[model samples]
Target: MVCATLALALVGCGASVPSPTPTSNRTTSPAVTSSPETTAPADAAAVFPVGEPREIATGLSAPWSIVFVGDSALVSERDSARILELPAGGGVREVGVVEAVQARGEGGLLGLAVDQDRRLYAYSTGGQGNRIQRFALTGTGGSFTLGAAETILDGLPSAGNHNGGRIAFGPDGMLYAGVGDAGSPQNAQDPGSLGGKILRMTPDGGIPSDNPDPASLVYSSGHRNVQGLGWAQDGTMYASEFGQDTWDELNVIVAGGNYGWPDAEGTAGAAGLIDPVLQWRPDEASPSGIAVVAGSVVIANLRGERLTVVPISDPSTAAASYAGEYGRIRDAVLAPDGTLWFVTNNTDGRGDAREGDDRILSVGLAG
Candidate 1:
């Protein structure tokens, strides 16, 4: 096992910093509004890692996301386009392969989500572009398998890299997807483009009537590459984005809010553009999947090789755990039992592959 003991600490909240003024000739959105401050979680001070991480599953090839279905964990392998089931009894089994997945640089089967009705949702790169499909999950335990693939949404954008492919069900039961610019920075600024935006749709792929634009699925816009989306208990949405050369950001997502992407990487404070609540250097935090649990936003970092915990009360300050111990951390999700599960990405051709290569590790959370 590559697991190791690690300690966690929570730092006191600091003074708020002022937003920077817009300095570039970026287009502004008249309808955009400033993101409101996130409401503090009820148990804001209770969440923290208590013990050493335990390896739940290993030998996964480039696992990207994990979702639970009736206590069974489903994981998506990026390049292989395979969906694996990790049963509680032990060992992993192939649920089925995602057909038509065009496995390119960073494009492939990326995110997995399970709805309350036991339907599985997947975001993958298809032959034409990136798409979201729904599958009927059948059987149970080791016998679990996927039914037919029903394409719900398709042809957003696709590229070798920057394919933002995280999908989740919001507290309101709406399906939310994070899409990257697909290597085209201008796509983020185009209102008609679905790339580089957070989209909200009904479970069956219909645009929600309450969406920012009645005719569009765009909930928010101007994102470079948003890979993480989670909601606090109070319904405050948070998203983590990848910046080009300077900064990566954790932002409070608000409807019709425009995040300065091609023009502003981090906290630009540009007029009419919402600035991120917290910004980190790209090397320190190429954060991917995030889970809002207890009172903290737990982020899995790939390049930084750490798990960053941002207290809900103070979004600006953060604490790190397991830095450089397990190599590249890709996804962080809260298990049904309330534990935090994180995936390692050493075998994704970006990090040093340890003996086990990729793995799913869980740690107990206090309170």
Candidate 2:
């Protein structure tokens, strides 16, 4: 469970956990194995109905993000600043270390993106501010190492918390990064600051010429702290944002659009500012990483401690599943096999940890 101290370390002081929603009545699947790996039964999606949640990898500490490379995945540990590889069978091993990461509160190594060429990109808190670095994955199979890294972009603001760090490649092949307000509400509306904005750039970190701002990297602004980014098949981008105290948000991002932050938290209908498609009470959601699964947007939450599945057709009618089962899911990514793989964040100096806590969980989704 998320404690008050964690709320203080994250969104604000005197913050309490949100009220629990009705738990989904579903049967848990057997834990995965190294061989063929335990899979969802024929009635898996029926018995469990929504999806069958199973444990994949365990004993992780503050795992922030995951990017797939073949049947394996590269995961980032927020506090440790190390990238660990979890192979197909099971188990995790360190593949590389990001330099100059000041892992504090929400600032540290966060978000990972892998290109077609297998090059890896990471968003981390550097000495000056948040930076994006690219690393080459050398070798093959279980014998791999992260080669020398090159800084792609830097100088984004960083604070104890609210250092928005979610990076993903758009359908247009442009790199999109989410940045927080760095605890400065003014930055949310400041066009000069990279904070509180979604930036669109080339794979090499160059500003896309087609951006809303020719010389600026800001794709969208006025975000309090955006931690999740996903794209629908139709190219519609969805973002999940943390709120101040009242409400959290799920907005459909658009170029040059502004999502009212300090000016507004949720759907305020403020002129010139775009409103979120879906809004949840602070306790009901503090959404983090998101992935589009089976035509639906799946969001992982921290304070709410659940998985929210929103149909792209009508996001306002989103449903919550696996409430309070795995504890503080920080990130979710679709695997090559069509299953949704997510990492737990209970050991991130917040929630209570179980025997082999901070695990990577999987939910089978039909194609």
Candidate 3:
């Protein structure tokens, strides 16, 4: 019965929404698989969002990521290079601008992450290439400001699109970054290249001793454009990837695992290649930032314009909410209060901008 359901979902219901420009000629069917190590928490399957979404803040221009520092929320604006802070009391203010951010088609100030020491980490496109930097976050609340930028990693491949800028701290306290192929398809297959891989490094930007290659930062490879990284309580890592033309993927990330990119897309069932647990068409799911909540992996979709909830217990099944209700959803994260906070991307030079085109909104969660 589970296999039947999985097969049914492979042929997703097509939506009338416009699809992104095609990047590859691969046309294939969706695939689904189960990982024994990915079982969700006992109470996770019952957790779901309740009530209407409330606006936490508005008037954001092309915001990309949200990370909480204590009671304050820090948001990264993709084109502006400004980090906006939303205090617990309400209202938003600019913390400071990240220097040397180059905003192109899809490259600019992207992911934001906060460490235990109250320091901030950002992944962005720069004059040389894409880089990751750490900053000392000073002050609190409205007076919060960012100290000088400290380069952690730099010289990564960069392009107008497919920059794959998403950074996060894993449960192991190691920094992880998702990088794209930068319009170079062969780069995904090149193990020596930093492009099209998930890199794991220490807080100080050193490669972890236990990394797949002790001297290298590459954790996994063969990814087209990975924009989301999250882990369940059990430490099962999940990622969302943008496919060339055929499908978008939800992959279970493993150390040194090779995901077929230029060779095979969606589910080729090829030997020596890891297939995604679930795949969606580009129009129905241009998945971006994701958050692992309770028992489900919540995904933010751009072309699909929805929040997709996939139960970890049943990886093949999916439930989508607010399809086309909001325009071009970009990022979703679990707020400090357990509510689900999501950012829209209508004002990002794509999609039709609404009155408040790009805003951060939150909805209550219930079990």
Local accuracy of candidate 3 as per-residue lDDT tens digits, 1-367: 0111221123222212222222122112233233222457665663455667899998899999999998889999999999999999999999999998999999999999988899999999999999999999999766799999999999999998889999999999999999999999888989889999999999999999999999999998889999899998778888999998887988878888888888877666566777676778888889999999988888999988888777777654565767777889999999889899999999999888999768999987664
lDDT comparing candidate 1 with the true structure? 0.82
Predicted candidate 2 versus true structure: per-residue lDDT over 104-124, tens digit per residue: 989999999988788999999
Better structure of 2 and 3 per TM-score: 3
lDDT of 1 by residue, 111-202 (tens): 98888899999999998799999999889877898999999999989899999999999999999999999999999989989999999999
Angstrom error of the Cα, residue 338, model 3: value is 1.0
Better of 1 and 2 by lDDT: 1
- Residue 275 displacement in candidate 3 (angstroms): 0.8
Give the lDDT of residue 225 in candidate 3: 98
lDDT of 3 at 166: 96
The model with the greatest lDDT is 3
For all candidates in order, the CA lDDT equals: 0.82, 0.78, 0.83
Stretches of candidate 3 off by over 4 Å are 1-37
- The alpha-carbon deviation from the true structure for residue 238 of candidate 1, after best TM-score superposition, in angstroms, is 0.6
